[model samples]
Target chain A: MAVSDEQARDELGERLRKFVGRPAAVAGAGKDPVNAPMIRHWCEALGDTHPAYTGPDAIAPPTMLQVWTMGGLSGHPGRTGAYEELLGLLDAAGCTAVVATDCEQEYPRPLRPGDEVTFDTVIEEVSGRKTTRLGTGYFITTRTEVRVAGEPAGVHRFRVLKYAPAPHRPHEPRQQRRGPELHEPRRHQEPESRRRQEPAPSKPLRPRPVINRDNAGFWQGVAERRLLIQRCTACGTLRHPWLPGCNACGGLGWDTVEASGEGTVYSYVVVHHPPAPGFDPPYAVALVELAEGVRMVGNVVGVPYDEVRIGLPVRAGFRRVDEELTLPVFQALSSVTAVER
Target chain B: MRAGERLEPLEIPVTRTLIVAGAIASRDYQDVHHDPELARRKGAPDVFMNILTTNGLVGRYVTDHFGPKAVLRKVAIRLGAPNYPGDTMVLTGTVEEVDGDTAVVRVVGANGLGDHVTGTVTVTVPGANPEATP
Candidate 1:
């Protein structure tokens, strides 16, 4: 006699319970010691210029805690059979698809260059079978304790759902599979009647800047075709993308200084996919370091996206994208122009 | 930091290079973050940003406002809309509470689809008090 589905679920839940508190990984070591190269790569990729993440006494970005613990493409040597066995059971039970749900991390101490990293993970919990938008599945959570030279540094809690695909409607197209099950469907779907009443526009306007009180003056400057950098009244320090208080001296009083429009491409990335409104694909967005010693983000004009490079001299210019929008852009200066400068 | 104080918004263009670069940099070799064809097979319209990269971006947004002296103590986030390449994610923050040197900031990153990430970050900024300044 075949067991009832409810009985099968209960049996599976019981087996899953035993897996909890079991070691997922034992004494896993980082593939590489925390070093400048990896930190630099992370910084460049994220466009993070925090001085704390660099220099002789640099501490790794706190968010980098998990990066050091990842097993990478080759996988980690310390992973135990119990974790795999648990996953195999779930797969055999028809919960094959997986999606990371959420993560929680705490950094007790900062990671620094040359720190030897090691970690151990344990299966913290496995939830009972449940139904979600994706399908019926279980949520498996693991907690990892990361250390530097035998001292506690951080803790990471990662959770993922192993679910079988939800049943599709018979008439629905099979190729019309949904995006990542983790993300919600678009929030601004138009009503079918309204959408039919007025056809959608051909091109989308550029996303408007969120002009709040702190940055309103900067946008005002842009309207006047001036790139303004904030100057601290007390410390005379210059800051870009204006903030409420001075970071250098924590001063509240500040004024604006018009940029000289001279800068260099500190870093850049070429956008290629998913297609935003009002812009063509394969364009360069650069972090331009102004001569005033502050970096600002803008589009790189007068050059192909691929040609934009670090340290390339550029001049700031304003582009009126629409009636109410004027943006600061950078014009890459040719070698001849750089020589003239 | 005072409660209800808002941080300036930061706009980040989601680019394919950023997606691939961030995945590799964070040691997350997920194919959906790089291989578009594979991503399509997995039902994603195109390659999308990984959660690690989103976490890094959120961390940077907070630190950039608090300056180099600031340190992040905790960051807990939940993903929503996918950050596909060629889109934009605008990160906004509000200081929800403050005690001594540590402040809890509520950060929301919204893309074309909607809120991509919503979470709170605990950051400690040395000498963050504006009133104490002369």
Candidate 2:
């Protein structure tokens, strides 16, 4: 199966070009998965023991090489996953581009564990930014195909978007623009001129687990079904939990309040199997944007064991994971997805 | 002066330049961490920092502060930015919260522009004497 830009748009951002074109050759593809830990993890996680993944000998995990299989960086000092190229494509084109917004993956065939993978990627569609009261955003769809021993293993679909000038209604007032102050320089330029010219070089949050303060309030609210975000009073930026100051504006004071919990499926993954101890398979991890402009990553639950779709309208439901922690899980508002593919 | 009291900014600050080798030590090879080509390609603006350096830097910050007596138990890092070569980052931690033998530190690093790493750290000494009792 092959995909192109036009084909992807028709399928609502499916079929990427990078993953197109089979090697046109295959050999000993079915006998590889006998002895691989990564593959075994996938099998245990998905609980899928297809023959290709569990033949005579053990094979690597189907998604085992994900960490090791990052392909060559095709540009200047590549970051992770050709991220620069992806972001650059959007930064130059879209006013505000976000990454990993709507990510979906599925396996058409099983990959043997020991079989080496040849990954290819393609672009599907680049949607214009959609505006909200906070700012405008857009979507970029990509397709990736994973091959082992030149055989199809799985397909990955990703949708990235960034909102600039947030997609507000035409009737919305200019003062209520979703983007930073109009007086500021170009979105990309403002940061370059600032002291923290680049996103603060990721330093260790600490030598140990320092609380992600930004999510403190959200975590605190997790105990309550009241999902809350830190709203900066100075610049009106909506941030999750609390931080010393705003990422957008250097504000110290913040107000924590409940989130509407009504949001679309921004990004999601079907964890075929558990990654650690005490985790069950057939669960979903998703990033949902509540009505209040902030995005939260939590488990997406309650759909039929299968059938979790993109753009699904979901609401927040909290489950206590620890005495002081309540995890946020999303259940479908209705069986129907907001914008069915 | 009380032990572990906040140190004021000395007029003449103590600074050292650490030359970190770029050889692969950990299993982590995220391209941006070691490969300059991969890093520049990924849109990092530049290679700025990694979890490993941050780990070492935190030890340096505390070792310098505690003079070998401040026992360190925990240091956590959630990588936010990429650390590249020829970059010197400053590690700074503040005693944000202090409890009975335990102290919670709010730590961050900067290349002078602003913070690159941000997180809290908790360190305990062998025998921490408190100022007041319960």
Candidate 3:
């Protein structure tokens, strides 16, 4: 039995490798032009203020490179069948789940306004089966060469992992006791009595915040109920949403300051649709501008969702929603302390 | 990880519009990317960016620094943090190894919260000095 299993795996690996150089997507010219409106929309979405993206001499934000080639809602027609066949083969092997692993891009030049974009993508590599925290899977990487007016301008390499969800490990009792953190919120929305009778299916954890050497301090602050902002020690420029370097002075040295927990809602939105596992619907999320002049995003609780608005005074507080999580939230100040600033 | 082979930092603004627009452009209709309330309901503080957008930004970061002549051969990135609106993600990379025409680069993108992306990108910089590649 073991020999047959190994043989089957080896056969599949050989098949997947055959697709390495096959065209995954061939985009047509100006399928979506690199235009000012789209660029403006992109800039507005990203809150990027670099002057290079604006005005008559504006260059498309190099990050917007792939946006120009995106097939949008309709998708592109040049996608060949080989990519799908490989996926189908994986699916047949019970590796039906998929997640994007990573991607890399290379630019030969900057994309400018009025530059028409096109590209042909090739399946670059497929890795041997491997195990990850998520599950057992194979990584598939693709390379796309982007062009302007048929000239090579950039290359985009994307990768994804197709895997089978690992069988429930009996040792992982913690996972079996409750659904993933993402689905935890839905349990709250449901009545406690109902939850006791019918257990929901297990859900994966909510997408955890990315933690690495640069911003681990901030997450540690979140755990401590202290909102720590990165301050450039050299320039004294306080920045939020923690950054590695100071935008004002390009300084890399930094320290942290605990926010006073005081701020006003700079902007907000109320979400109602698309039911998710952990969150209750129609909650208000705000861009709370701290007194320190930096902005942070969090849920505004302790007040009706409809009441959240621009300039509402709020105080930072911690919400311990799950056993493993404690997030910083904003509570509207009482009418007495609430002054429109 | 060569001392002299460093990529100039690139700044990417993370705005609500960006989180939503990137989702729309990539045809990712997941509510956590566009609907703030739903994202919160799903246990996120706000609408977080999708991987596709992050992937695109990484591509941009590399190409922007390597000039138009750099050809990305492979990009392998892993998500580290949730990039919510109101943060600026800074991307930095360093060439780790160079072999003939191809050079390997290690990159990390950090935001106010934490490292948003950490990965390795491989590229073939045609005509790049042997010292830069080898």
The candidate scoring highest on TM-score is 1
* Candidate 3 chain A minimal-lDDT segment of 10 residues: A181-190
User: Candidates sorted by DockQ, descending order?
Assistant: 1, 3, 2
Q: Candidate 1 vs candidate 3: which has greater lDDT?
A: 1
Best by lDDT: 1
Say which prediction, candidate 1 or candidate 2, comes out ahead on lDDT.
Answer: 1
- Which residue runs of candidate 3 sit more than 4 Å off their true CA positions? A1-8, A27-30, A167-341, B1-18, B25-48, B55-107, B110-115, B119-134
On TM-score, the stronger of 1 and 2 is 1
lDDT string for model 1 (B1-134, tens) is 88899999999999999999999999887666888865553445678888788989999999999997899999998876678888899999999999877899999998877788888999999888856432
**What is the Å distance of residue A20 in model 1 from its true position?**
1.4
TM accuracy, model 1 = 0.63
Q: TM per model? A: 0.63, 0.30, 0.49
Between candidates 2 and 3, which one is better according to lDDT? 3
For candidate 3, give the lDDT of residue A193. 31
Worst ten-residue run, lDDT, model 1 chain B?
B37-46
lDDT (CA) per prediction: 0.78, 0.44, 0.68
Model 1, range A78-185, lDDT digits (tens) per residue? 777988767756654545556666778999999988898999999999988765545557888899999987999999988877765453223333234332234443
Pairs that collide in candidate 1 are: none
Model 2 TM-score on a 0 to 1 scale: 0.30
Better of 1 and 2 by DockQ: 1
